[model samples]
Target: MSTTSGAAGAAYDVAIVGTGGIAAIHARDLAELGERARIVTAVDTDAGRLDDFSRRWSVPRTYAALESMLEFERPDVVVLCTPPGLHTGQALTCLEHGVTVLCEKPPALSLAEMDTIIGAERADAGDGRFATVFQHRFGSGAESLRRLVGDPRLGPPMTAVCHTLWYRPDDYFAAPWRGVWGVEGGGPTMGHGIHQMDLLLSVLGPWRDVSAVAARRARPTDTEDFSAALVTFDSGVVATVVNSLLSPRETSYLRFDFAHATVELEHLYGYDDASWRVSAAPEHEDTVAAAWAEGPKGRGSGHAAQYTALFDALDAGAPPPVTTADARDTMELVAAIYASSFTGQTVRRGDLGPGSPFYDRMNGDGAPWAAAKETEVPA
Candidate 1:
């Protein structure tokens, strides 16, 4: 794992791992990157899927296994779009081989898994070669909001509401890992709501504690179909979080209340500048508008925006966006939400470790479904 610049310029040889729905997003985004990057190869266990991906993306090579891809092509980065359970192992292998990784959301199934991934990264110090696909962080809306949050013109962030309420039918969980705690981790809180929470954490900083409750009201799955939490950030800002897969009218919404303005984002999956609005106090109205006008504009929240930034960091020999440290913080928050919910107590940050039950598994010692009232899905 060395950060050797590829080609005479900054062009990188990229590889895609796991040709699934999310992988398609990465492949398409990488294709539009033009000369800045190239999809040298793609990997998947299914030959037919791999072949289709290779043909669709015009990737020069395809492999059924990661080992073969590393041994033969050995591209600059491996985009891990595999199952959540395989993330840590796959990421460790890539880092060990000196290959950078851009993994999808819920970076690791548990904090212990995250620690293992971080250890591998540390062993390859200067490499700093791991990044997660928290693409929401790169959009123009997030960029603008991050700027406003820092600027005193908006004042300190005081409170927020981060909600990811969407529907997922039982057939959607036929993929095996979708609803299980061992593989997919938690339900909506881990998979769906993580995006909004990541965006919220990006603005509010570290959370001090979380008090939450999880339930299985509609989905017939091993994991809780829904979870809600009250999170207190270290910055003194408190927020409410609701993660559910039973909402008929779906939305991924976040509202940040600052001293001078209220900034909100309402979108299902990805967001654009239009999806965000800022309501400023009378005295700070003009100032907030002016500050927001400073452009990081037009870019939509998707893999392209994030991938471009990741490639640029690699090009400049800098640590990429959504580093392991950052991912760990988000994962810890997820752990806290589960721990608090399952135990009926507020989970404080820094309390979870090897000694804590939630440290090794998101479900902790007890089963989430057992504690919550389970609802049977119709056949």
Candidate 2:
């Protein structure tokens, strides 16, 4: 474990692991940050990809192994764009060395793994912090809606809709680890829909319980291609969530129905102020419109928005946004959806922990379809 000069009086040094497509976004956003952060090194086992990434991003250094990069150049923060299966271990390593970690979505394959990562941060008690990428929560539209959650003008939230319907062809899962339960964790529920689910949880404080169903509809993979759940928040706000990778027309939509207004957001991946709409009850139309108009605006949701907030938190010596504890809430929801679906029972927020099967793996009892697929005789 080595240490680089702190970012006390300079830009935070950042090292990006895994030069995949997502890493490009991280590099571009950090570049846009100008002086807040700097990409000092790039790491990847693929030599060709590493070279290309370094050249494209103008990153000064590159390494084929993560340990070597951490040993020689200890960046203040390591942005992990690696696979889900590797997130827990990689994040643990960074925290052990007192370097903050900004990991991509599905930060871990299971709640157990996520807990380990969170534990590492607490045990370190140093400058290291762990933050997951849940960019949807930082968008201006989401910010505005969050502010009005209990605002008397909007009243109490009623029912909600959260859908992540997208398409991924067979070739899209050509990568060996793409749809595997042990690697990618679960299909759309864990990978694709998590962004919107995280955003939903951000708006609705704490969820109470969930009843769900999952199926391997069309995708030829080891995990379910689609899932749906009915979740109830502590505030008595019930929501229907549907996540699918089989839809032909892709859409990521969320609707929150409050007593006085119905607020909705429609977008594919990211959203801005323009993606939101509010419809008010007759008596509160003007009030709702004025409140919506006065809320936060302009900032679009993406890596940049979250990164900007993260840098500000680091500068102020505060825990970064989307901290492990905060992410745990969203992750627990993912686990509950799976547990409820597989067990044909309602799963409450505190139902899963160390003793729960779903805590260690999403397909805790083995997805029924996957079991059947394995037993099918040669046709």
Candidate 3:
């Protein structure tokens, strides 16, 4: 069961828990780490996926259950790419066994679940920890903009726009869990748009309040197909968020208007340095141009950049990027958006807790609208 190589001392033992399509991404990124990390095993309930992943990644061991994998392989790190409903439990299993976890986005279905994962992670005193895959934060362009946030030249971020508008056909929701509240949590807002929103939260920091609306206008799914929100950041930045699955022309875009310059990132899925553009105000044009040019370059927003940084953290015995606290901030935004939309109220950072329905379910009290609303998309 244990596939510890002789080079175990030179590399961290890495195992993947879910052998889905996304698992391939994790494998590819981990493989790029070379000897710094080794793919010790892969786990999946599906025999076909397990075998395919192992053969494709050259992983030496495979398991059908997480407990068996943990007992046998004892990987130093585990990647949880399972569904949103399963993320919390699977991640808890790994952390309880003192294994670090790199969980995919929407790390938990609800705030309660996030609290449970954070508890387990805290109890585990070792270097083994939890980090979320908010890969957009690692982009060179994003890093540049983040750095510029603190500079006086840009002043404070005043207003911003975040949008994730992509088309998902009927076939995309054929899966049983695709649009359910308990399973996938929410529709485009929670699953698809979260990437850009997380990136937004990363650059802007904590959100103070949210007023939003969600509709199941297009998709024939239980969850809302579209959502829009007005967000107020703690730093007094007001922003608008729009997440949709009905757009024929797909795009993932974020724009931050600071006092002295406007920064924008335009891309469909992932972005490189070239995806970002800076338009400086005339008064601070020279300073902004020079600062942007001197920022970090070349790193693209993807799993590889994050995984490499994770391994470096493991080597240094430091906490990895996008820690649970950081991920919680993004999750809080998600909860707030839903709470506001369904309840028709402005949701604050503390509004969602054990007492609020949204604290435990994305579609609090069943969305307050009919699933087959008149605006439902026709197949």
Best by TM-score: 2
- CA lDDT scores, all candidates in order: 0.87, 0.91, 0.87
For candidate 1, write residues 43-129 as lDDT tens digits.
999999889888888888888889888888768788899999888888888998888899998889999999998889989844638
Writing each residue's lDDT as its tens digit, candidate 2 over 1-379 gives 2233334324688899999999999888877777677888999999999999999988999999888898998787899999999999899888988899999999999999999998899999678999999999998888899898889999989999999999999999999899999999999999999999999999998999999999997888999999999999999999999999999999999999999999999999888888998999999999999999988889999898998888778767899899998899999999999999999999999899988899989999799887787899996
Q: What lDDT, from 0 to 1, does candidate 1 have?
A: 0.87
- Give the number of the best model, judged by lDDT: 2
**Per-residue accuracy of model 3 over 240-317 as CA lDDT, tens digit each:** 999999999999999999999999999998899889989999989999899899899999988988987786776567
State residue 287's C-alpha deviation in candidate 3, in Å: 1.1
In order, how many clashes per candidate? 1, 0, 0
The TM-scores of all predictions, comma-separated, are: 0.94, 0.96, 0.94
Off by over 4 Å in 2: 1-10
Give residue 201's error in model 1 in angstroms: 0.7
lDDT of 2 at 356: 87
Superior by TM-score: candidate 1 or candidate 2: 2
